[model samples]
Target: MSDSNTTVFTNPSSFILLGIPGLEVAHIWISIPFCAMYAIAVLGNFTILLIVRMETSLHAPMYYFLCRLAVIDLVLSTVTLPKMLSIFWFNSREIDFSACFTQLYFIHCFTVIETGILVALAFDRYVAICNPLRYSTILTNRVVAKIGMAVLLRGSLLTLPRPFLETRWPYCRTNVIAHTYCEHIAVVKLACADIRFSSYYGLLVIFLVTGPDVSFITFSYIQILRAIFSLPTKDARLKTFGTCGSHLCVILAFYIPALFSIFTHQYGHNVPLHFHVITANMYLLLPPMLNPIIYGVRTKQIRDRLLHLLTHKGT
Candidate 1:
């Protein structure tokens, strides 16, 4: 028994990330789209950050939350994608123990922080629509700063236990992570011990963060819609709803894919491994890529700013 434990530490213990398991022959081919998406995701989110910073007119609560969200998206896209592209482009799949855990921490941290920012944005919309008279007074600069800090600290604090949890388990089984990114459970599965505690804690964290977050955001929108309908003018109704349309679309895009991935991971026992892994990858990458597009196309201010930048560059 002691000999086995010693062997587990000294053997081929570094994780071999099986990125799209059976598609080894086609990995180089598959890298093309991944590379393109990574570039777009990084560039788009960076543009959002830059526009928010440079445009003094955009220093409102809405744009402030957006700035925070853009930061999270950039980190999320950056942390997960380069390594994944490396897997595809160069077949670099071996990840050491501490490195894998570090990746896992940031991946989840960004996810939870994204949810918090979405909720913060939802509250901003709700106040704007429901109590327009006090919107500015209520969500002042100080209040907005507090909320941003809260979102950042909350995500950091909640997931702080992850490294400790991961450290408890020793990897003695095959060190091949089934997915490209270092997901908590995927890494935990490589442990030889029972995983009930880790699994339940993970579920608890997900439910605690995402459950209330989704519900709160949905409720905020419901209130916003009702307040819009109460407005007397048709133009008022259209303008107010249109203002929120982009956020609504964003909520749907993010949650639909995320929920589907979660259900498929938990219940789709007979699903193909590559399909599951690819879907997981999509959940992380797609939002970062599409979020900037959705905001740029739907939000007039961002759209006009982006257009002005482009036309100026063209000239």
Candidate 2:
């Protein structure tokens, strides 16, 4: 609130990112694991993309959705982790105003994109399992392309307003963000003006994006479960249910941490600052690291193809 601490203009020249508040002393130690996770995520996601692109038989709606998810994961992590690591390793905390806003937009936008893609994946399973006979017809290349476009547009357009809305506010308060990246709430809280509209819009974005996506995913799975159970043979039921296992794991890995991070940011006043930073980082890192591993391990086709690729390279 002090004028001396405030920026004179609407936007500050740059914002300082405090990597992790209480854990600053341990930053080097922390970056070790964070760097490892980043490496794994990068390698795993690229492998998924490569394998899916190379294998002709894997060119179906399901794999196409997986490829989309991989790209989202890569972008999601890349947007945040490198900057976070820079802060941790080199104590490089200053980010230009425009660069920070760009990071903020990409982080939220891709998060929503990931959420939408999860719903698409759920729907792919629903059609594949519940309506096996019509899977190919219902989810043709054209239809899949349309769904991908819709998901991309929905995320990009919805989050486009965030940076603009932020720029409208004059940041008269301190410009130090206490988390790794330019998180929306963290950055906006530094504004001197009334932030009620921004707050409400944030909640609205969640409700509009996450609310419907979660509902659709749940509905799709219910139908999938019903179809699996109705199969005539136990073997058929088990075999069919097995197909959804990787997706289920992926959904849990993605949403559980994400929802935790969101709710904690909204309401967990008593929680430690380090807890928040760690949770936020985890939500971004864990899914990207785990998603490809989950699919590679659980999906036989991908696993075999991955093995074949490795073997061929080795030979």
Candidate 3:
């Protein structure tokens, strides 16, 4: 490929990601699995949303936050999976520059929003556990709605600059994105202009959004653990831990791979391309898949309600 037709990168337009010559073979092999995962993620998250909406008994602050989470998971998975599945199945891995940027915007937006939602959920748990007498008055439906709106607004504001900055750059080179979806870093790296400012801004936004969120979550859990330990009876302590176990499991599953992917992409770029791709997909796909299962098995109310719904539907 000619230099004029490629972006100003270290590599040329014909550069194969991960040193693989073409994506045709990989696409064929990955299509089936990707399709299955996409289907499962969509259906599972949708079911959780429906269950939360329909079950009046489950319409508490916790379930309200859960419903919000289900929506976020659905949006997050939907933003990337369908496009990815299409690429794999149709062998049309090409994405228009504008569409790629749009995808990148939403991907970052949903990710930020989900992080905020998780933080909000942690706060909700904290209120319930630490201030049982005031929990009802504190976490009313109106308050949850306001929190949801704020989270969405913050996510949108933080990620809007990324795509806006990307659009200003001229893409004079090949448009082939090696990854399945148009990731923020990957797309920005393809720009023909200096991206140091953009990168720094991106990192700053990430830190602002995730740093305090993760810290608050950790603090909430610490206090929860302390409260559990202080319970006079062994059974009470066990029950308290058991009640929060599902949330903790989901939190770990969501954050650990996410941080790993971030570290690998930023600092461990020298690692194998296949490894990066696998970990990236795990970060994108695993939380949605595991979240429903975690709640279903760990939370008695959700599990019983889901089972009842299934049995009633069968009849």
Candidate 4:
């Protein structure tokens, strides 16, 4: 990298985040829903973690993955919200360059982690459905530990360069981010320098990690569907449907907002800027709120456990 690339900016070192431009009058109003969303996300994910920890029967590979998902969702929700809440509730929008890049790094990390997690959860379902006899043997506690470590390593390694690359870019324009949070493309677009390299690499990272993970998960579900159709009994099919449906709901929630944000940001040139910004917020906040509800409502095991915990507490 050229020294010019890495040279400290003589201009303001801090950036102002314009939270929903032209919606200034509505920020306080907007924050009510945003605050509600964060509360639901945290309470929901935290309950998942607590149930998974408290219920002995829920310690299987599926629940283990669910537990990790809750952790990631909680972290993802946290990383952007505190700053965002400040912006919405207190009009505190300025963030130092280092803090902006740090937020970007963590947001990227959470994306990778969530993608890896969905893949893992899909694999867990595939094993349970297609090869029930061997599910326990294949995904032993040791194997689960190894998988957890691998996902963490993968998420951290692939995204670590993003902040450095973004930081080295020479910035000279108005130091204002369009959205509430520090996302890779959002930050990269602010640089006075060309960002083609950074943009392509961001796409490459998505392709290398998330694209493959989503593909494998989709393929796994296809095989699982085939296995389900071959089941001899209707109850067997319904039982499988309940499990797969909840997982698919989570997958859709996580991916749809993600794809919407990516497509609109890339190809939806005619799309309004606020639409993209709102979609970005949805991309970060929706899954954390929805994942627990989907599981809690659809999964018999979790619902039963919640009931059991509640009934005992009432007694």
Residues forming the 10-long window of minimal summed lDDT in candidate 4: 1-10
Report how far off residue 282 is in candidate 4 (Å).
0.4
lDDT per residue (tens digit) for residues 1-315 in model 4? 133344455445787888886787898998898999999999998999999888888899989989999999999899998899899888998898898988888888878988998999999999999999999999999999999999999999998886787788777756777888886677776687878877777888978997799799989999999999999999999888678898899999999999888899889999888788888999999999999999999988899999988999999
The reply for model 4, stretches above 4 Å from the true place, is 1-11
Q: What is the lDDT of residue 11 in candidate 4?
A: 48
Higher-lDDT candidate of 1 and 4: 4
How do all models score by TM-score?
A: 0.94, 0.96, 0.91, 0.94
The lDDT per prediction is 0.83, 0.91, 0.78, 0.87
Clashes in each model (backbone N, CA, C under 3 Å)? 0, 0, 3, 0
**1-315: candidate 1 lDDT, tens digit per residue:** 233324445234467787787787888887788888888888888898888887889989999898887788889888888888888888888887777888888988888999898899899999989998999999999999999888889888888786677666666766667788887767776677778877777778888898899899989988998999999999989999898887887787778889888889889999998888878888888888888888988999988999899999999
Q: Which ten residues in a row have the lowest lDDT in candidate 3?
A: 12-21
Q: Name the runs in model 1 displaced over 4 angstroms.
A: 1-13
Best by TM-score: 2
| Model 3 regions more than 4 Å off | 1-23
**Candidate 1 to truth, TM:** 0.94
